[model samples]
Target chain A: MSKKVLVLGETREGALRNVSFEAIAAAKKISGGGEVVAVLLGESVSDFGNELVAYGADRVITVEHPHLKSYTSDGYGQAFMAVVDQEQPEAIVFGHTAVGKDLSPKIASKLQTGLISDVTDIEGEGDDAVFIRPIYSGKAFEKVKLKEDGVVFVTVRPNNIAPLEREERSGDVSSLSVDITNLRTIIKNVVRKSAEGVDLSEAKVIIAGGRGVKSKEGFEPLQELADLLGGAVGASRGACDADYCDYSLQIGQTGKVVTPDLYIAAGISGAIQHMAGMSNSKVIVAINKDPEANIFKVADYGIVGDLFDVIPLLTEEFKKVM
Target chain B: MNIYVLVKRTFDTEEKLVVSGGQIQEDGAEFIINPYDEYAIEEAITVRDAHGGEVTVVTIGDEEAEKQLRTALAMGADKAVLINTEDDVEEMDQFTAAYILAEYLKDKEADLILAGNVAIDGGSGQVGPRVADLLDINYVTTITSLEIEGETVKIVRDIEGDAEELETSLPLLVTAQQGLNEPRYPSLPGIMKAKKKPLEELELDDLDIDEEDVEAKTETIEVYLPPKKEAGRILEGEIPSQVSELVSLLRSEAKVI
Candidate 1:
């Protein structure tokens, strides 16, 4: 039942993203006692091979090219296609990150195969891996299995799967040289809206706000509470539409889908679109002035009061406790 | 400029989904063009208006999908094409959808192809890039801004917490993200004009693709709703007392703190 699987290790800002390790864990699950090979692509990422091995990869393949130092659809697609052609893995896995979403489909088309994307769970064994993914913006879940026999491609949603415990395993590391050329789309620059913090999708704790926060400055207390809780700050689409925050912070049906362990909705009214993104969180806390607010319907704990009074008190209490 | 927009008919975002026997119940369900694809249709109309060309909206679905295609035409697309597969293909996934679409578009002399970043129903965000790859054309996804001059293209796409600027060229495919532009509603005149617009229907045989050739590569085993959450506990007390109780619950019961 064993089958070789390839895991594409993702990197951002010269550091390995947490999703990369999670992907290795997923690859190991369906690997069926076969080798799990991790593929790392960047300008200079050879040093991360040992870490990938420790995370349960049996071997690591590194592809270094200047064009890959930053992610471009062409560069990453070319690099991934080359590695896929060389390795010919029975199954390929990637974290459903920005890079993965952009590159996986391109590779799938080149290989004339199908890709089950944003998979939250994996079952079955060897070539019969069954992937569970959300459809209709998490309203329903679908279990999908690839029908093709030769090779399969999948991208796992971040934070859904647990990574393997670190162990000292002898893993072989090899280097691959791929000619990455004829780039049509070139990345000029990336403009970050906020300083680095817990990735919203992967955060265990999330403090989110909505139009009830009132103004751009109203999010300060929520941000402070989020930092204290070691979580990311998110906003509902209503907040983004009101120009209270950037759209990147918006969590809704049209925005990012997040499932944190602890989700605090301060002032969010819980529009269906907003709930679609975070309703699956393990626990939800709603703090709003409206007693009849829709957010309370999904919240495990509801405080019917003004967030202006509730958020600061919550932050203060959390500060004292932790 | 020959512009093409890919559209899909999906359940309205606000409709409650009900699963029966591993399939979604569509009876009396309100359907609309996938929300994100509205941005593509709007952008296609804008591009065609600015560059002196025609806009064609294409969709792959059953007869019911014609309503969504007509909606796109009413939104200003000059023409509409529906590739009905209700009888030919038993299962349809992103791969098969893209393959059929790519086969149809291969000879269309497309200068610009636009589609939604991802369909809300599927949320895969793959078809645009997949079609682009199959046609050996350039593509960008989650794009918030796009500018075209002659054969040069400038785009700004949404990343997680930021924006990425890129430069590409013509004969490119781009997926419309949320912030791209405000999609216009169909005007009274536009709606009436759409009634007379050329809405062509094609079967799998018309595209020279056998059902077996474009067979879905994935199969769905089951469909179910996420577990329901218990009712919320509303604490009754002064602000200070409620805060204390909440903290206690977090530390002892939830243990997330």
Candidate 2:
């Protein structure tokens, strides 16, 4: 049952994202006493190799090339394939992030293999493992497995897997020089809009708004409460469409799916589409004056009062308690 | 420019899913064009309009998928093709789907291809890049903005919540994420024109693809609904007291805080 699982350690701003380590954790679960070889590709990424090692990787392969500076499917795919050819891993794991979502499929196609994307949980072990992923957004769940075992490609959803605590161990780091070719897409530049803090997908708590939040300025209070609780601000599609917030903060069937520990839906009416994103939150608190709102139906705690009133009070009360 | 947009018919996200007999029951389900693909169809139409070319909408599904294809045509796609795999193949997954679609598109000489970032139903998001890979072309997924100047193209793709602005060329495939564009609803005249837009129906054999060549790589071990959550507890009385109790409960019962 021993299997060699290769994990792609994804990076952002010269550091390994938490999901990369989480993928290593997943690889450990499915590794079944086998080796976990982690690959990091970039123009410069020796730290990524050591970081993956600090978390959990039997060996590290740092695929470095100038074209790997930016994440183009062609560049990353070419570099990873070179590593794949050399290592001959039986399985591959990715974080299911923006880059992972875009790159994994192309790599799978090159390998002429099957890929299970956005897996939330892994059950069983090794070859017989089953992957659980959300279908219809988060409204339903399905268990899938590779039909015929060739090379198992999996992309694990962010925050769904447990991230390893950095143990800071020195692992075997081998630098790989790869030739990245087939130049197609060139990075012009990147625009950074995400607020620096708890990543929305991985946040422990979320304070979400809806169209009921009204103007763009109406999000100020929600942001305040989110900041107070060290959570992240989220928005329903209605809020995003109404120009109250950005689409990146939107959560629905068409947007990001999150499973936060505490979900505070302020003005959201809990549309089926929006519910598809957060119905799985561990504790949902609905603060709306309408007692019959659909959000209350799915909420674990409901306050039949305006969010503007309830949020500030809750923030103040938590301030005292904490 | 010659363009193709890949579309899928999926369960309407608004409707409640009914899973009976260990499979999702489709008898009473309401199906529509996948929402993300609406962005794809809309973007394809926009690209064709700006660049002066024809847009073809393609799908791989049963005869029931024809309705969704027509919907795309009504939205301004010039032609539609339904690759009916119902009689030819079974248990289609992302791999099989990309294979079938890539085969259908291999000879089309498409200058540009567009599809949804992910389907609302399966949510695999592998088909666009997979098809592009099979066609040996460049691809970008979850794209928010696109611009074309002759053979040169500029794209702004969503990377997490951030954006990566890139430059690529024609003969490129890009998946349409939400915020790419507001998809147009089929106008009355557009719908009328769509009825006569030469909807071609082809089987898998028409693409010269054997069933074994497009076999699905993954299998559904099980399908089930999410576990039901307990009913919510409504807090009444004064807002201040309610908030205090909520805080106390979080610390005592929920323990999340």
Candidate 3:
């Protein structure tokens, strides 16, 4: 059977999330010369039909309803379930965002199939898809194979894969509707925080800190450096526990997993938890006073000094170039 | 209102894990309730204390899981439920576990469901959200802070680099992360009282879920030690020569420059 890859696109406040396009680009690679279907469920599909094709989706399977405007588990799941049942795609891919995180497992359960969630890598392997997931709080890597015969599910972590653009290519756009009267949960409203710049998960450059950052005042330098490079800031679990920063900024086993192009660790001792989150970055740079710190193990570049000094210099140099 | 806090007995993360024959060796290691889940239990118990609700601690594991269950009860949960699943649970994927738990909560009067954002063991982080999906309940994850204000739940989750706050009604599902609340230790009296509290044990059928419903999409193919690290060479010299040597290493050998 020819491969048909289905991507579960995500939306934020009634618009397609960037990760949705990134997922479609990834699914197209796994298509192996088969069709690419982007499954979209929301209140309105009229506005997103054209953008879906620009991101390499051969076909757009849109499921729209008034109740589906906000994110309700039942409404969205039912819509995707109907689409999957109607068209038995070989594999389904999703970007592991909040909506995708909530929707993928339910779809897997309804289908009585298996899913590889939060996958960072995927490759086609002889009639089956091989998925790479972090196990043991990112201490280990597990390569999983979806054993089911048809319609396997895999949710890749956002920003891990680069998005691609395609021109002069398009496919069918179909609509789907399902009964959601029995849904148990409802999203009454979706409130968003108006923040500028890329999400940490999507940033190509990252500047992270740890407990060694002394005090809350120490974070300003890192922020200054991040701003200079148009990057995001991350924290270690210890720093979060110390209240030097919010837990949301913490990057560790219990926190967000990010894979950026350039990752700079400042003052972090590189605990296993912290490593689990950002170890997958393309290039790693560590700045710490402790020469014996474990962060140097995986760091492509290491500076055995104070971040307060090194960061300002680096930021200034980068500013001069940009 | 009844609150359910899910707990899992896992290997102590502080200890170095040894994988023998593709299974985690826990013969000599200590076990405890997942650290993150401790926050969930603490938050649930706090909610119960303030609102006059019953807090039920639930787990799906072997009889050994009872120790953690007892610990939670000792910490002041009103009751405990153990789905004795060790024999049949080779590796119950998140989907199967969520389906089973959702069915178990079907007729129960639960106003809130609390789970750790992710178990350190499986590290899938999909269970809580999947359970909310199966139950069709509003789900919020990575909640760093939570406040209950008379039938409403306000949550603060970390998004990108900022804190994103959400407001939802009762009878919802939430996954707790660190900083949500500090888990409390069991008082001497509370520990003693836990022995008298009821710990209900149920079979798989009690959850109204079949064993075959959940299929494992991913399995541990193998577990082996990571690659060895190269010893660092001590560069002892004047600053200029050391910098020159480092530059040489980067340019010629490492080629990372």
lDDT of 3 by residue, A1-322 (tens): 4578888877664567778888887687677778889988877775686678788888888888876766655677778888888888887888887667767767776666677778776666435456777677656667777655646677888776678855766667888766656544444333343225556777777889998898889898888877776788888988888888766677877777888877889999988778878887766778788989999888877777777877776666556545
Candidate 2 per-residue C-alpha lDDT over A1-322 given as tens digits, one digit per residue, 9 for 90 to 100: 8889999998776567888988999998788878899999888888668778889998999988888888888888888998999999999999988889989999899888899999999998887789999898887889998998788889998877887788978789998787777789889988777667677887889999998898899988888888988999999999999888889898878788888889999989998989989998889999887888999999988999888888888888888877
Interface RMSD per candidate: 1.1, 1.1, 4.2
lDDT tens readout by residue for model 1, B1-257: 89999999999989999999999898999999999999999999998888889999999999999888888888899999999999899988888999999999999989999999899998899999999998989999999999998889999998876899989999999999999999999999989999999999999999999888888888888999888778999888898899889989988898777
How far out, in Å, is residue A137 in model 1? 0.6
Estimate how well candidate 2 is docked, as a DockQ score: 0.84
Give all TM-scores, in the order shown.
Answer: 0.98, 0.98, 0.86
**The candidate that achieves the highest DockQ relative to the unseen native structure:** 2
The candidates' DockQ values read 0.83, 0.84, 0.32
Error of 2 at A190 (Å): 1.8
- lDDT by residue (B1-257, candidate 3, tens digit) is 68998788887767687767766678989898998899999999888888887999988888889999999999989899998876666677776677677778878868899999778877777778777766766777767777889977777764444556657778888888777888999999999999999999987776666777654555656554444445444344543444455445544565433
For each candidate in the order shown, give its overall lDDT on alpha carbons: 0.90, 0.89, 0.75
Of 1 and 2, which scores higher on lDDT?
1
Error of 2 at A273 (Å): 0.8
Model 1 CAPRI rating: high
CA lDDT for candidate 2: 0.89
